[model samples]
Target: MPDAIDLYDPDGYVDGPPHETFERLRNEQPVYWQPMPDGTGYWAVLRHADLVAVAREPKTYSAARGGVVLEDLAPETLAMMQDMLLAMDPPRHVGYRRNVAPQFVPRVINQLEPRVRTICREIMRDAAERGDVDFVHDVCAKLPSQVVGELVGIPEADWPQIHAWSERNSGGQDPDFSSGYSEDASNATIEMAMYAIGLAEQRRAEPRGDLTTLMLSMELDGEPMTDIQFGSFFVQLVTAGNDTTRTMLSSGLLALLDHPEQLAELRADPALIPGAVEEILRWANPLHYFRRTATRDARLGGVQIAEGQKVGMIYTSANRDAAVFRDPHRFDIHRDPNPHLSFGTGEHFCLGVHLARLEGRVFFEELFETFPTIEQTGPARRQRSNLNNALKSLPVRLCAV
Candidate 1:
């Protein structure tokens, strides 16, 4: 047995791959108990099948009970959070997500490939000229913000603010990323919502050919989405799109760097880029887990969970569960039939998944094509939070052909 107490500190393995700890937990404690910094505790579903069962039965496992984190939010904060799609239960959740889902359909997202490529090329060209750049901020972060910006019809000039707000919203636990507390994060969220509300009002007055226009014109249950609703929705899309895609590209590069053989194969055959992207999602899923509360007593993997108890689909552990994945620890770019739960499963699968995939495939294609001699120049810095499994810094030297 490993010396580490697996659930003693959930944030301990936030920096790099926690394969060792996760492996031990999967074998010994599939439903590990984690005591939070507060007096609260939760059941971490550490196996693949168990996590999927939790997500599949939303009626039994609710996202709305006590909120989705190990540390329960204040009642007011929880009320504020209910505006987000991820926090809603069925019927309401289904309606809201469905309203926005059509815009993110595979066909619609596929059409953005050309624009994604252009953005990636511009970012790469800029980095190539610099010779050395912080890959996370200068290169990887740009793509998602630009993509989300265009989708929402935000001006290019406002992209920086949007990025900053998204960072603050997701970065509450990381002192380096935010003011380091929920109050600050809440304030940032309010500011972002207010900003989004202004844009919504403007879009309502004169519709533009963009997502903001579509959202402003959209109706949920024959009523237009309130400014408060739009605010939460905007924050979710921008924040979710920003950090997760950023991690995919930045961490994907880190993975490629670690495995030069796979990198070479990808370089030799760019068609493998899409397959490689899937492998990256499998190998470096950006989230540790997402929480759900059991509405009533339930049995998962023969373990009983009571009503109002917090339960998480431990994606990090599930992605590497030996039951679901052969050689689960290996980083194989050619691995077919990948069943990673990074975008999640069942009712709450990420709406922006198609867009994320497009950005990943196109960005890497441009990255490999533009910079034939790219090398990691320094160690990467990880985001300091259990919630966001992301890199804060990635230093690389690029040589443009």
Candidate 2:
């Protein structure tokens, strides 16, 4: 008889936390088998240690083979996605990661805290004056687009277009969330790539002292990145920054709302916001999981995973793994020695981790400081996607201090 594997239904994970089912899987079948809607099933690595092992052994488990999603991307789409840093396999992945590492290093991101604060203050001000606003659009969405626009040489005026495109690129997975349009994600990806190509062409003539300049001048394997290459890089940075950071802000607020005492603690001691940010990341990660494919047949956590099969390193599950965190359900902002996989693990860890954290810390600090009496005036709504676990609407009212 086949092993009695704890099977989790993906539909349960779409709206929000799949705590009960995930808890059962974690305790009973740490390496669970989950069925896909399209008649396929995959082994879910539910334990934190197993996830680390899967990430570390990239030679056996690849990001390139079947692409990251449960269903394989079309050949053409797969080729385009392979150009992304997240999807590329080693030697190339290593080289590209190294090339961009200097730009996003901790010290560099740390310097942007003041600028981040300014952006957050402006965002808070715009929302505060309204008294009531859709927190997702008015508040959470601004910092990401602005930060990304500043990072690249994109003009501030063009931010809305970029934001729209970024939303579309990440949105095709959710028909309801993405303007109720059934636009193909591949088309959006191509459009974004083309937009970046134009920007690269413009920057090539007169290099500004910004990230666009860096991309234009910087060499990849002794060759300066082509316009096509810059397109891939631009899409990756823009879309990743757009979706994930927005999730952080929106979800972080939800966490605070759920934990009143912790929220009060943060208000009393603003210094605790730093640790609170870490806890937020741990408690409610922006992404559900990042999928990786196996290059060769491998055994992970004693389960025999077939070659070329897609495997997801579920940060959502790993962050709450009983072995890794104590009182895992509790949101303790003051929790120390917290090591969460919100940014991922291993060499392929998120390059924008520091910047994301800096933005989160500054945004929350400014939020509490400016609006002392912040509360959810209406019901919160969630996005409809297994991939993007975020709020669609948080009806909030903030009283100006």
Candidate 3:
């Protein structure tokens, strides 16, 4: 009905998200059937309400049954993904999340504000020194890498490697970021997991007051988390934390720069930075969608979905759903009751929501304070990936205050 929309093609997302296509799909076919190259296809849950319904009913729409990606992953990779919280179904998901959730609660995350601010200050100082910089990599990527490394007690020297592996893992569709080989992506995950396993072993022998040690000490399903489990959990935490936070910061800056008046408002009253962060998330959600498989024959958005069919909770469309946000296209920092599904919903909601928000707020605060003038030096480049709604490069000039 919508002129053969191809939501599965990574090429379609090279410039940016197919928001126009998404808008049309939401209007005509909220539960659109999108065919993938592999003959199998998923029901793209475009509307906000429908996506929520799918997410709420984990038993009906299972993450583990097919893993989270639209394409079928290799058996080993799928096994690793199943180990991560994102791809697990309850009550296993519940047990594992319960063990580590305490480390990420707002009260605990708030305690890291001072350190996050320090890191942001350092990043801003470096960006100010390099007046012209690729904001995506030089400015935005540094904070998450450092923050996650510190959080997980990763060796300072290994941070860059972890970041590189993360990029490869998430950037498989982007040739610039990835080698364009599926094996490379899988290898990156395995390599990271191996590294994480070693870290767990080291931390086990010499416990430290860090997340790594805490996680290793925690019990899942009435037993201590094994090294393999820690490896999967570590991979998820580092990769998710790094890529999503980088996207948020880079995209958030571009959004503010595009709307100078809103940017000015943020600079005038830094208190509004948090609200602006939410709007940024709503506007440019880092990940486009997360895949789930129908565990049984089910009906969603008036369409019948058979068992084993993939279902994608398309956050890009849902965030801009007219039914949810009034004037959803407008980038308003003060959008109260902003219920964007960027961090997802239900049992698999993001574990690092507080940390992500804190990083966003502090990074913006320090950025505006450090650089009074931020100008776009060149056109921004979006990542070529259906899953990752992130920028590949954002060239900008920053003038220090």
Best by lDDT: 3
Q: Please give the distance, in angstroms, between residue 202's alpha carbon in candidate 1 and its true position after superposition.
A: 1.0
Residue 347 of model 1: what lDDT?
A: 88
Error of 3 at 203 (Å): 0.8
- Residue 131 of model 1 has an lDDT of 89
Residue-wise lDDT of candidate 1 within 1-401, one digit each (tens)? 54456453536865565777778878887887776767777898989888888898989998877666666887877876777888888888898888788898998889888888888888987888898999999999999999999898888899999899888888887788777576678788889989999988888888889988888777765798787778877887788889999999999999999999999999999999999999899898998788998899988776788888889788888999999889999999988899999999988898888999999999999999998988999999888777777899999998986
The best candidate by TM-score is 3
Question: Per-residue lDDT for 376 in model 1?
Answer: 92
TM-score of each: 0.96, 0.95, 0.98
Candidates 1 and 3 compared: the better one by TM-score is 3
Candidates ranked by lDDT = 3, 1, 2
lDDT of 2 at 18: 79
lDDT of 1 at 204: 82
lDDT, each prediction? 0.85, 0.82, 0.93
Clashing pairs in 2: none
Clashing pairs in 1: none
